[model samples]
Target: MAVEKLFESENFLIVNKPFDMYINSDDENEKNTVTYHVASPDSHLSSSLFPLHFVQRLDYATSGVLCIAKNKSSAARAGKLFEKRLTMKYYLAVVRGHVAFEVADIEFNVGVDPTTADSSHRMSALTTSEASERCLQSRHAHTRALRLETGYYDNRPVSVLLLKPVTGRRHQLRVHCSAVGHTILGDYTYSGTRDSMPHRMFLHATRLVLPLPEEPLDIQTAEPFFSDPKFSSKWRSDTAYYKYRNKEDFKGVCDILNKSYVIGVQYKMYKM
Candidate 1:
């Protein structure tokens, strides 16, 4: 799979990560990971910056903007930004059920099961008592949602959500959305077979805001799965729910999102 470069500089690189590929895999034989592709000899990057480092991670099934550092020093600098929670990560997800509020925050205690391993190790929301018992290890996760639109998919209620994760835990948005009875579409682990699922996970990491020493880097990726005709066709044919009839309308949507969330930052949009 070809990785699409969004932005590139001497110190930093941002790419549109494809769905179903790991940002970095533990196994050396897994050649399809982002790290592998970026380090390939045929890649545009210089061999001097061989081991490009990922500042953050997106799940294998999720697609969107990913930040890569050109060198170790740059990676360390970017890591500090993430540690201080100075980076604002935004996601766009298609979920089952109509989310009523325009803006809302979901807070929960998320922990991974110690018994499971590999992809089977699923994260779960712990009850208050459970969280208290394991306070030392468990993490407090918070996700904020801005409802973009509420529409119907195959006569079933579906909503487009713009999610900002205040705290980045594993699967924080997915677990929070599911806890609220509107699991993300195609998230079989959380949503179960409650409603019809999309062909792939409906969550996309739409944007990232990183505050560097010089300036803030705001990067965004064009909606890959969100605007797919296969998914949109499922919406009610009579309504304009999921329709982007032309390029102008699509650009309008992008402008609205940029204006609403990413203010006063040098922003760039990348293709996938």
Candidate 2:
């Protein structure tokens, strides 16, 4: 599978990463990865000009905008932006159940589940009391949810959520959404089963904003698979799936949040 380039510059490259592709692979023989395509001398990009480095990671099943730095200095700058919580990461997800809150901030502590014997370690959400008792090295995770649209598919209620994660913890969005009783559709790990889920996970990294040295880099990607008629047919005709068709709608969301942030700049700026 070819990686789609969304935007590129002297300092960095942004690509629309497809589902099931790794940002980087552990094995040199593994050729199906974003790094391989961008860094390979034989590939379309000039490998020497931009020694690509992944700036952010997405789950194997998740799809959306991924940033790659051209050099060590650019990578370090981007890392500092993320560390300072100045980077804005937006995700779109179709989840089960009608989400009650129009907007909410979910705060949960995450820790590795010791009982899982599989190589793919599963992270568990710890209750406040459990967090204190276990004394496990836990990280606080935060996810902001905005209800973009609502509809039903196959007689089951589902909603599309615009999620902004403040903390970059593993499976933070998945766990927080589930903690609020709305698990992302097709998330077998958190939602229990993928029996009725779509072929791909519903989560997509739709937009990313980073404060670069030159200017703020606002990169966006169209909904990878959700906008396709094949997926739309499953939803009701009057759902948000139809309303959120263009980039303008996404921009409107950002604008509204920006206006809100202006009032509480300190705390709201870092959140959605």
Candidate 3:
């Protein structure tokens, strides 16, 4: 349960949180959470940044850039950015089928599924008719997906997507992806037992931007699975079969994203 420290300053600390680890757990038996490692006496972060205050949360099965505030004042400032929906979050994911659209916006309402026995823990997208018929607890979720590559995973068709969640709701990305018939690979709850299980979920939070005072805090983590020795053998990029409908538009989008990596201000051009 080691956390990679990505950035540290007087007010904030950003870390690459490993997948399959909880941020916090009510179960006393659990010791693999991010909070446990950060508070451990043996950890380097214990003395300087104890009593951790997380600005946002990543799912237990998702990994990447996670932000933590060093103190209360910084926490309040960072919290405002999130509350105002001024922060940007980007994620990388591999899904079950070839994504038809090169770029499309997925908007739907996500809520607890009363139809299933696991309603308490499982979520589903409520269709317009369904939403109007029932008074289920739900929220409007919006996400923009950019298909990066179409490929084969363990001989089954899959697509690599860069996801931008415009509105943060519980399991927004997962629910939206599934609603459009491309449930993320290795997402057991959404895809069910039909798809082959990978070592871990194929979703990773690749980048985060926090707009603070004089300068914005931007942090990025490399896409983990693409180069992973364990995952490479099973992944095959299919450049021949799939082609973008609008090649220039796709290329332009990629260029903007790449430029944003180096010139931080360039990200605003693509931000929705």
Best by TM-score: 2
The alpha-carbon deviation from the true structure for residue 13 of candidate 1, after best TM-score superposition, in angstroms, is: 1.1
Pick the winner on lDDT between candidates 1 and 2.
2
Off by over 4 Å in 3: 41-49, 115-119, 131-135, 240-272
Scored against the true structure, residue 197 in model 3 reaches a CA lDDT of 65
Q: Residue by residue across 1-272, what tens digits does model 2's lDDT show?
A: 88889988888889988877877765668787877876763232334454566778888888899988877888889999999999999888888888766666677786665555354446666655745443245687877777778888666888888888889988888877776788888788876665345776789999999977685799888866556666777777335523454687886775544333233222321121
Instruction: Estimate every model's Cα lDDT from 0 to 1.
Output: 0.71, 0.74, 0.73
Write one digit per residue (lDDT tens) for candidate 1, span 1-272.
88888899999999989877877755657777787777753232343336677779888888899998888888888999999898888787888887666556577777774544345446766545645443234577877666667778778888887777878888778877876778888887776555444677888887788889774698877766546898877865322333333434544444444354354433322111
TM-score of 2: 0.84
Model 3: per-residue lDDT, tens digit, 71-117?
87888999989888898888878888887666666767777766662
The C-alpha TM-scores of every prediction are 0.78, 0.84, 0.81
Clashing pairs in 3: none
Which model, 1 or 2, shows the larger TM-score? Answer: 2
lDDT of 1: 0.71
TM-score quality measure for candidate 3: 0.81
